[model samples]
Target: MIPNSGIAITIDIGDEHFIHAPKKKEVADRLLFNALNQTYGYNTVDYAAPIFNSQEKKNGGIVLKFKNAETGLYSYEKLNGFEIAGEDKVFYPAKAKIVGRKDVFVISDDVPNPVAVRYAWRNWVVGTLYNAMLLPTSSFRTDNWDDAIKAKK
Candidate 1:
């Protein structure tokens, strides 16, 4: 998860007031981060955990199960780059969609008997999945293959 924090300023004016600032989006984002981190005392609001524990092969695809899903399972704003691998251990681009259950998703690339699934598992890609809290899921892979990127580094 992206580390963030917030700051709280007290004014002796003794009244609640709304302050609007005309700033760039990124500037506003930074301010919001600091405000949230300072107010919530870190790692409390909109926190996400990577803990997918179950996977199943079905309908020429892979099904990922997220247990104890709070805020209803959902995807992010942009297209999520998903990859799937079969027994041959070669990953291919795939797409993810929420299936019957809120905590279940079907990732499909049409690979027969898919064995593994990953989401936004790249150095720079938009994440597509989130929980009810609107916290983005970190890049992750279900395979245990030698990390080529790590090896190169």
Candidate 2:
């Protein structure tokens, strides 16, 4: 996500030098800008590095290490759409928990040797993961697979 992408606005008008409530249009404009920024993947802070390597654990899970996560990891209070995939299976809903450290997440699924993971990877997705500053994590995937939309067409 780019800096200054998160939308918040302030407007000054009229000659009154006193504090006043925000106008409806001002509120609406702020909402619209924020919604658009999120929709365009410009309002969130995502991983600083790609998932270059994955380590399989004895418990049938994989460990993923992320950079730029020193701020701590958190999930949105109500949203969940994390997934994992193996060579033989497609991406399926899975569970991920921050383990050992703030930047290390362990993803567990039924598949053996999980090869890839993804989060909020959809057109209408709203971010489910956030950093300590409450910035959302942009949609991301670890696989280099062909674009699903283009493949379908």
Candidate 3:
């Protein structure tokens, strides 16, 4: 059962998010569940907790933005793990960091004038968000483009 707190297992860790992957019993086990069985009664909540997500594309220049990852937690340092693709249709982790409360900035460092931005859009994406109460939101992405670039071997 997915918890409402928005915490999940993935590779990316956002600004105000916490994780305990090493504690998971199985690959499918969620990180939050680790806190449940190992910590206090975390699973007691049967309903969806509040969720916050980041927003993107209010403007241009491949600006990365988040509506909410989970919640309370904010950014510390520049979070790596952003990828941008130009006309080449290649996706590679670009340089990324929290620019402000309403935006994140990303540069391809390889491609200039990038048009679209992508966060941890992967099903296993690791991201962050915060609620109004300052709690972590959850990992999410902005672009759902059907033509997303797949990594080449």
Candidate 3 or 2, higher TM-score: 2
Model 2 TM-score relative to the real fold:
0.54
Error of model 1, residue 51, in angstroms: 2.9
Model 1 regions more than 4 Å off? 1-46, 76-79, 147-153
Q: What is the lDDT of residue 137 in candidate 2?
A: 54
Pairs clashing in candidate 1? 5-33, 5-34, 5-37, 6-34, 6-35, 6-37, 6-38, 7-34, 7-35, 71-132
lDDT of each: 0.56, 0.53, 0.49
What range of 10 consecutive residues in model 3 has the weakest lDDT sum?
Answer: 45-54
Off by over 4 Å in 2: 1-58, 104-109, 147-153
- In candidate 2, position 16 carries an lDDT of 35
TM per candidate:
0.60, 0.54, 0.48
Candidate 1 scores a C-alpha RMSD against the true structure in Å of 10.8
Across 55-148, the per-residue lDDT of candidate 3 in tens digits comes to 4443334664443333323543456556777666667677765454545677765666565556555655444433333333344445466777
Superposed Cα deviation of residue 104, candidate 3 (Å):
0.4
lDDT of prediction 2 = 0.53
Q: lDDT tens digits, residues 1-153, model 2?
A: 685344332322112354442455754565565665565565553323222234445367666655545666666464466677777547666777766535435355456677777776654444455555444455567777874221111
Q: RMSD in angstroms, candidate 2?
A: 11.9
* Cα error, candidate 2, residue 21 (Å): 22
Q: lDDT per residue, candidate 1, 15-109, as tens digits? A: 23334323345344545655565556664554333347678777778777764355466764533577777777767777777665355444554
**Rank list by lDDT:** 1, 2, 3
